[model samples]
Target: MLMEELPPEAMLDGPPPDADHLLQRTLGTVREERHQAVLRRGRITAITSTFMVAGVLAGGVWLGHGPLVGGTDDEGEVLQGTSSAGANMAVKVTETEGGLRLVATVHGVPDGAACWLVVHTKDGRSFTAGSWRAHAGEVTLAGSAMVRAGDVAGVSVVDHDRRPLVTAG
Candidate 1:
């Protein structure tokens, strides 16, 4: 009879066939390649996401409008005030066509207390930027001074008695 006419059991009555081994090897290779491809795609996706987040943060900083990154100070310097009497303050000095632009923030100051901004220069000169009474909460003050660049040594927040409530540089 022909090989095709043999019974199903007769077909496996010898040593394990070479065809089965080859098929198994081929299947294993295919599975491994598929797994590797999946891993590669995952890694690529992770890297791409990280880059996207970094780009967004950089853009926000460049725009000069984000938490911890406000008002452009490219042409000036930023000074942080030391907390005194339970109040915190910060100052930013920016150069303008007329002179210097001063921006100040005071927080936790005593309510209704008179507070003044003092700008001290490195050349033994001092100028009062502005003054205001603190509110129940935080307060922001702005002013301008006709001072030269690189001359400002520090800034101070003083009470009505001229006692420095907080100083910063």
Candidate 2:
């Protein structure tokens, strides 16, 4: 008879042929491929995390120490001052048509202390440029004086009680 008609105990079979080897090989290949895919994803994640961290650090540094944040200008005159009370200041004086524009960065002052930015003239006159409550860290103040930049003798930071914190010429 034909093969289809000769199936009752005619085929070679005490048991079905073992397919364990084939199955094992197929499973092993699948496992290896999965492992490789996981490794690739892990590497990509690691690299992306590294770049993100580096970018944040770089931005922090730039904002912390850059000329814009530090209140420095190439065209403005820079003055440095310090006080016996451990306060420090850097003043950038720029000449404007109406007056002298002052940008001052002050540090080492007590938090919540009321302070003033005073511009001292060579003629022994003082003009209050700006005022603010001092914070713990660095504080930036901006003010304008009616005097010309050439007439400026110095700049000072004083407390609410007119106590001098720092002065820079």
Q: Best candidate per TM-score, number?
A: 2
23-113 per-residue lDDT for model 2 (tens digits): 8899999999999999999999999999999999999987644353224446779999888889899998877656777889999988898
lDDT assessment of candidate 2: 0.86
TM-scores, each model vs. reference:
0.54, 0.56
- Give the Cα error of residue 166 in candidate 1, in Å: 0.8
Which window of 10 residues has the lowest lDDT sum in candidate 2? 64-73
Residue-level lDDT of model 1, residues 72-135, one tens digit each, is 4564677987674677888888876556788998887778888889888998788999999888
